[model samples]
Target: MPLPTGSSQPVYYVGWDVGGWNCDANPASRDALVVLDDALNLVGTPWRGNLRTTLNEARDSRDLIDRLLGLCRHQAQGAEHVVMAIDTPLALPRALLALARGDAVSALGRSQENPYLYRETERWLFQRGITPLSPIKDMIGSQATKGMHLLARFAPHIAACGQWLSDDRTLTVVEGYPSPAKRSPAFAALRQRVNMPATLETMLHQPTPKQQDIQDAWLCALLAWSLRHAAQSVAWPPDSMPAEEGWIFVPVDSLTPPV
Candidate 1:
């Protein structure tokens, strides 16, 4: 489908979280998107859906990415400067790429090197003109590791989307938190500081398997909005930020799963 066209806006951003049973799954199982205005308020309900297939087939990831891009294009039909933050790694640093090609398990180990590799991979994407954010640096500490179960299944889909997209500058993929702890301090702090509406409570209470994906998507969308308007901090550098990168949106998250 063609991207929607309408009145122009100062900035538009979309955040995404791709869900799957494994990194190598044929099709992504669940996905979420959040659309936001330049102000960064909750502009709309987070767009939640699934790919309707598995990522097992080689073409599965490609098809899923097309659908995802379509969703972003459709949602942000009128805005200028679209930014996306995804919950998967967009690009691998050369070192980790070598390890991934060698023993995947060894690279997946919960070690400083592993996360450094991941961070470097993200920085590499930034240098290449792709806006890639590392949720690990923002949320999880260095020692934390991504669960193999999750990474092995989802990584391929993320990789596929990164490879298929031609303009890395326009397509941003950011690592995001997989799931938030219920009633946790972080959740409360986010709500209190952001003044998130009560409607989001329902999302937190829902029992759906994709709850985490939905919430994270919303958060990514918020970041996208911030990137457009907010100045850079040490934690969030303007040049490294997704908004500075491109027009399309994607959300990524560190592999660290919630305990």
Candidate 2:
């Protein structure tokens, strides 16, 4: 599938399903990646593997960073805006951090703001019927940390509005939760009403573990696309939400896919 022509600078959307730190040893648990163009067409063949090979091949830290950029580029031939959506917790709760510092914090008993388990973003999703997992209480600490590590290396600067901006200001990174996002009204509408690529059907019917990862990556890519193109539909966190806590980007039911 090809993107719509005529735009001088193409925008590439990347969705990455983070795996364990040592994902190379486990094929079923390897990280999955999906790249999409502005029109939502697959950019290249989806990739399932870890960063071991890329890191090993590089001569130094700078070379490693270059190789990582190449991996995200895939087959794209020119400079483009890259928006990577990762399915993992990018930050921990503020209250938990405060407590970790041995501050006198009051208990959050039964309150949705459980510092040890839930971030404000997760609680916000819970109020809207989407349950996001916790890195502290859940078994996803490895993946969560992996995502954050990548963010620190690639786009450590957080914008005032909470967007993760790359050092060069070309790449923008966002957090995503595909489990609840796939069930969102926006996804349902996109699946049933949008003019999607033909490969989408094959992906939809298959339920294998690796396939699920790819599907999740694709959904995350969709969120990235929506955030870039359909801003009105994106569920932007309130200004009150701390930029350091991080925010998950997902479109609401009002999303209208570009023609």
Top candidate on lDDT is 2
Q: Which residue ranges in model 2 land beyond 4 Å of their true spot?
A: 1-7, 52-73, 76-78, 192-200, 254-259
Window of ten residues with lowest summed lDDT in model 1: 141-150
| 135-228 per-residue lDDT for model 2 (tens digits) | 9988899998888877777678886444787666656788977776665676766545334456765775464876877778777877787776
TM-score per candidate, chains pooled:
0.47, 0.83
Q: Which candidate wins on TM-score?
A: 2
List candidate 1 stretches off by more than 4 Å. 1-8, 21-29, 51-79, 98-110, 114-197, 204-209, 232-259
Predictions in order: lDDT: 0.42, 0.71
Q: What's the distance in Å from true for residue 259, model 1?
A: 23
- What is candidate 1's lDDT per residue for 1-259, written digit by digit as tens? 0112343533445666664433234233456676666554554556566432423332422333444445544433422444455555543344444456773434355433354344543443344344443434443221123222222343322322222121322233334333322223433443344434677767744535546667667666555544444423102323443321212222222123312
* Clashing pairs in model 2, backbone N/Cα/C closer than 3 A: none
